[model samples]
Target: MKKAVGIDLGGTYIKAGLVDENGKIIKKQQFPTLAEKNDREIVLTQIEKSIEFAFEDNIEGIGVGTPGVVDDEGIVYEAPNLPCWDKINLKKIFEEKFKKKVVVENDVNTIAWGEYLFGAGKGSKTMICITLGTGLGGGIVKDGKLLRGGKYSAVEIGHIPIDYKGPKCKCGNIGCIERFVGRDYIVERAIKGIREGKKTKIYELVNGDLDKITPKTISDAYNLGDEFAESIWIDVGICLGAMFSGLVNLLNPDTIIIGGGISQAGKILFDTIEKTIKERAMKILSRDLKVVPAGLGIDAGIVSAGALIFQE
Candidate 1:
């Protein structure tokens, strides 16, 4: 079978995998990206090492998924989290060394493409794929194709304004969906509640350490019958639903896939979002659109990167 090498580069970790042309991952490995503590050369070295771990003589091509604004030719203009990844010609660098066809794209787009070709979105013609983690990232597939705009920076669904008068966003906007539902935002909400003396299981789990009140702690609290934790998750769900309601009214996608670590809150989180979408979205769109969690689990990054080649 034809083989390929795929890389998923993130702020915290870099995952590399060997995949068959059929979209099945044959082998996978990871390394700490240390994107912040390291310079461009160091990070590139880490990537090189990961590729070495997964490399085989017969690999046909290489595909990389980066969390940044990547041009069609695999140049990264900027990575939001990794400060050193500015204006890097990742494709040229890797191809010069590996002598293989290399393609690079935004991480979210890779995830969406993986789903489109091999996972939950396999049959959908139009879909919205979201990953809720340190921040929200999204990719839109319209009419069975990735919607890359003129500058390869379209469908950044997370930056959409949810509350015009709310907090300032990193992108210089006010009250983006990420501002409401991102992991840091969620933790901040929990911290605010703790400071205000709103008691929950989160405090016990974190042992009164406010900084330790993570999303998992909150989800755990909700699972353990803490009303305060439930409220927090529900609030984020409402924000997500409200935002998607607007998306449904505008783009009318057939499926919406939610992934990333934060989405593991399971029923408590999903139920509220689904309820809000059904109540607020266009009737036809809500009735027809299927909103669900991702199917690729932790393998998404590698599989999705591999998909950039197969789907092309």
Candidate 2:
């Protein structure tokens, strides 16, 4: 029944929860991040407020999952959509404020570790977990430990280039896997298809308002037997699978876990990725590989933040 406070820091909202050793949330709450204030102190106070909402006496520690590059000392760097977020020692600040041990890590990395311990990847020795949302984010659990770069949490899997000469990514990379399958990119594909005179239920789903289209729209269209929407999801799966093939060859992980909103496309995306990886990756390396959705569901962020502290 050991418990800890978990904080999931995002651009617009902060989610906090009390999680026990079994990865079950005992209590949880949410608060606005107020990052638009463009003041570091304001955002910091928001995080503190979230912690206070979830903290209790004699907890093991507080774990915060944040969006950024986290260094070994729990210092965050280059965090987007936050004011003056460069090189802030969140661990030190939280520890000082609460007199408890603090663990800070990149949000996706926290999710990866959480899955390794309590989710779909519970028994896997090595796992690759990716969240496909507004952007792509990923983390790796290798050899029963969270993989880290030399100093920072370097697993920025979204930025990994799938095509060196393809479309430019927001990160200034050419043909990043995310550039192909990220939320905006996926929506862009649908728009492009519609403009090219491809008839799809996507247009009907949004009443011909292309700007109103989203990945969910496409998913709904696909559910209604729209071939165009199906093709879009398949293409995205291929893009992701192509990138994962290289990773499979290099890391030989046993499981690849896909999460986030877009992953709800269900069987089509997962099956395509699995098929593409099997055909493209080394047969021996991929023969036992499994592509599965994340197990943590809606409260993944909160539970995974707590898992960071519970991880051995």
Candidate 3:
């Protein structure tokens, strides 16, 4: 069986794996990103070593999923999460180090591609995969192909403006969907509610440590029958559903796959989101549109990264 290397370049860690064509990870390894060091050469060297370790032998090509705007030629224009990745020729570096054909794609796009080929959106012609975590990220597959815009930075659903004058986004936009539904936003809202002395179990859940407030913490509290946490998820689901409605009207895709840590909220989140969509979206577009959770889990990134090379 042919083998490929997939690398998920994250801010805190670099996850690399050797995967076969069937989406099975033959071997996997991880290393700290050490991005704060701000040494591009050192970072690249470390990545190269990690890939080499994962490769071992018989690796045909390499696919990298990075958290940034990657050009078609595999240059990283900018990575907001990693400060040293601006305008870095990641493709050139990897290719030079490994002497193998290398393809670089946006991390979110990688996930979408993975799902379209091996996960929830498999066999769908048009699909949108939304990942709800620390920040909202998305990948759109149209006609079973990744949509690369003029600048190769397409499918940025998170930045879609839901409000023109709402909260300022990290992307310099106002009222972006991410600003409303991302993990930070959820925690911020929860903290604000607690400060207002809203009666809820979140206070005790975090043991009075506001700093410990996280999306998971909120979800856990909600699972334990905390009204405050439950309300936060309800609001999150509503916002996500509202955003998805617009997408459904525009793309009319067969599936909208939701992934990431928060997706574990499961039925509570899905039911609320579906209810909002039913009430807000056009019935014509919403009909037959399936909103489902990603089946790949954390392995999605790794599998998707490898699929990049295998598919080529």
> Highest TM-score, which number?
2
Residues 28-85 of candidate 3 have per-residue lDDT tens digits of 9898888889888778877988798887556878989999888878888768878888
What lDDT does candidate 1 reach at residue 285?
Answer: 79
lDDT of 2 by residue, 1-312 (tens): 889999999999999999999999999999999988888899999999899999998899999999999999999998876757888999999999999989999999999999888899998988999999998999999888999999999899999998989998878878889888889999999999999999999999999999999999999999999999999999999999999999999999999999999999899999999999999999999999999999999999999999888877
- Please write out the lDDT profile of model 1 over residues 75-182, one tens digit for every residue: 897688889999999999999999888889899988988888788888897898999999899988877788887877567888999898999999899989999899
For residue 265, give model 2's deviation from the true position in Å: 0.6
| Candidate 2 structure lDDT | 0.94
Clashing pairs in 1: none
C-alpha lDDT of residue 73 in model 3: 83
Q: What is the lDDT of residue 35 in candidate 2?
A: 87
Off by over 4 Å in 3: none
Candidate 3 Cα RMSD (Å): 1.4
Model 1 misplacement above 4 A? none
Ranking by lDDT, best first? 2, 1, 3
RMSD of each predicted structure = 1.6, 0.9, 1.4
Looking at candidate 2, the ten consecutive residues that score lowest on lDDT are 78-87
Model 3 compared with the native: what TM-score? 0.96
